[model samples]
Target: MTASYVAIVLLGAFAGGFVNGLAGFGTGLVALGIWLHVIDPLYGAPLVAICSVAGQLQTLPAIWHAVNIRRLLPMLVGGVLGIPVGILLLGHMAPDLFRLSLGLFLIAFAIFMMFNRSLPAMRWGSKKTEGMVGFCGGILGGLAGLSGPLPTIWVTLKRWEKDERRSVFQMFNLTILACVAISHLAIDGITVAFSQLVLIALPGTFVGAFAGIRLYRRLNDHRYNLLVLIMLAISGITLVVSEIG
Candidate 1:
């Protein structure tokens, strides 16, 4: 590969890894925007999936104590069950329009949340509601490799502390991304070239993730909440721009 290609790949990997580390989700959202310029979406998609899981795995242990399996189970179950359905819907849906609509919604929601200082934390959603959110997230993850936004938003609404929020969404995203990676592997076995690209990406991913985790540790709950909202807004903007372009 040319030096420029290598540079671009590493840039994307680091950016993705950093975002994943800080926010607990959003590797694909950040990386794919940069990687798509150098690689086809077919390759770019799986690469992001693999790299995202790696970044999450790298940081998982730090947040392990916050993971509550009973609280997390319903979301995981619903997410897993929704994936096949999302994959099925992918064939029928107009993906661009769907993404556009979702993008607008994310932007609007993020802005509203950012401004509404007096909004009360939502307490009405029990496990069933959480499962439904997870189900939507799975479908999005399956359809668009976007599983984090819905659950992230839900957790934010619940006003869980930063670590609890991070742990839940990070674990949820890790599971969803792992499933995506395996599905891609099943359909398209890893090529030698793919392995090579992964090797190039790992160091950047590790470095960026560590840096992000350090920043994450420093943030208070309120700051982390704002950070997530800002990231979601940026993600929305990215989606809208990509679709329109």
Candidate 2:
């Protein structure tokens, strides 16, 4: 690879890793924007999945205490059921339209949440509702590497404490990303070139994740919420611009 290619890959990996560490999700949102400029989407998608899994695993120990199997199971079940369906729809869906619609929704929701300071916590969604959201998230993840946003948005509305919320989406994203990676492997099998890219990305991902985890330790609940909102808004903006540009 050329120097510019190497630099872009490292930059994308580090950015994605840092976001995953700090926010418990969003590695793809942050990384793919950079990587797609140099890498084909097919290769870039799997690379994001691999690096995101790495980043999440690296940061998992920090949030292990907050993981509640009872709370997480519903989402996982729903998400698992939704993945194959998404994979099936992957080729049929119109890419530009899907990205545009999701992007606009994200941007609008983030802006509304940011402005609405006293929004009441949504207390009505039971486990069933959570499961449905997870299913949708799974489909999105499978289809477009976008599994994080829905769950992230849901937990925010649920108004759990920072660690609790982080634990939910972090674990969810980890599971979805791992599934996506496996699906890619089953279908595409990793090229030798892909393996090399993973090797190149590993160091930056680890270092960035570690740094982000350290900073995460310092943020209070309010700041963490704000940070997540900001990340979501950025993700939306990235999607919109990429689709339109």
Candidate 3:
């Protein structure tokens, strides 16, 4: 790759990683915007998906010790069930609709936090709730690759410890990434161009993941809240504008 192209990819990956560390989200969206500048915007979904899954793989080991296997199963079950349909809709649906929906929901998440004094830690719920969250969350995860929101909200509602929430969310996303990557590879076959992009992104993603993991350790609630709001506004505006166009 040319130096200029390499620079773009590295910048995107680093930004994505840092954002994930600081805010717990935005890596995909931020990476999407950054790469779109160099690559075709239509390629954003698959491209981000690849880097995202890679970044998660890197982070999962750090948080692997506390993964609460029993609690995680239902979400995975739900996510798996929804993946087929979600993938099918990826190319067919309007990107703006998807993005705006994400924006509004993110804003709502910030609202949920502002009204409450505690983070969601509602780990005590019925099997039915788990199943419901899993099924719906899976679909979102498979489709837009942002299934962490509902589960994150669920954790927040239960008032989980910050570490527990981050650990679990990290695991949840990585799991979704694995499943989605398989589908992409098995069904679509990673094309030559996409494969090249993936290679280009690897070094950048590595640096990003390293930096992000460091930040993830130091982040707290207030800063987390601000980051979430900013992401929501930015993502929302993008979607809203995309829709208008």
Candidate 4:
């Protein structure tokens, strides 16, 4: 790619990564719009996914204690079941439907979480429910290469403490990214085009992650969620606009 394209992708990665690090889900939403201006949308999915996988790896260490097996285990269990179906369905999905579906989900979920802000406060699920959440997450992950929102919504529904809620979210998404990275690689095959962009995205992701972590320390998560919700709405609107145009 040309140096100008590389610069744009990296700038998106920087902002996407930081927002994700601090807020937990908007990295792809933020980056996708920016990157779409530079690259074909097909390549855009995997390209953004790769950058996110890299940044989440960096965050795994920083939030070491935040790892809760209760949350992770259930989601992972559900994810394994959900991924294959999602992959199969994705192969048949029209690009427009996929884009619109994801956009709508983000918009609705963001709005609900912003106003609702309520969840169960206990480990209140059977193995069946946990697996169901993971199944939903995995399907979304396989489809879009990003689907941590379902599981995050699940935890939010449970009313966990704010720190626990955020921790579970980061770790769960990190896991979803890991799963999506593998699926994307297997399904799409690695391309030099993505590799070249990923090289540039790496540094930008780092820059964003550092900024996000700094902000994480300062803001309580209610504020954090509100900020991210607004971003999600903006990102979703842009995607729809892009499609319409």
Off by over 4 Å in 1: none
Evaluation by lDDT, superior candidate among 1 and 3: 1
Deviation in Å, model 2, residue 75 alpha carbon: 0.3
lDDT of 2 by residue, 1-245 (tens): 89999999899999988988898887777888788898877798788889999999999999899999898999998898888888899899998999999999999999998999598998898899989999999999878779989999999998888999999999998999999899888889979989989998888899889999999999999999999999999888988998999
Best TM-score among the predictions, by candidate number: 1
Error of 2 at 13 (Å): 1.3
Q: Give the residue spans of candidate 2 off by over 4 A.
A: none
What digit string (tens of lDDT, one per residue) describes model 4 on residues 146-235? 567677667666665446666676666666777676767887887887777778788999889888877777887567557656766776
Clash pairs, candidate 2, are: none
Worst 10-residue lDDT window, candidate 3: 224-233
What does candidate 3's lDDT look like per residue over 110-216, in tens digits?
56566775554454688677767867777787777767677766765665556676666666766776787776677777788788888888778878888888876
Error of 1 at 99 (Å): 0.3
Residue 66 lDDT (model 1): 94
- Give per-residue CA lDDT, model 1, range 1-245, as digits (tens): 88888888899999999998998888888887788788666788889888899999999988999999999999999999889999999999999999999999899999999999579898798899889999999999999889989998998888889999999899989999899999999999988878878898878888989999999999999999999999899889988988998
- lDDT of each candidate versus the true structure: 0.90, 0.90, 0.71, 0.73
Question: Candidate 1 — which pairs collide?
Answer: none
How many clashes (backbone atoms < 3 Å, residues ≥3 apart in a chain or on different chains) does model 4 have? 10
Total backbone collisions for each predicted model: 0, 0, 15, 10
lDDT of 1 at 241: 89
Candidate 3 versus the native: TM-score? 0.84
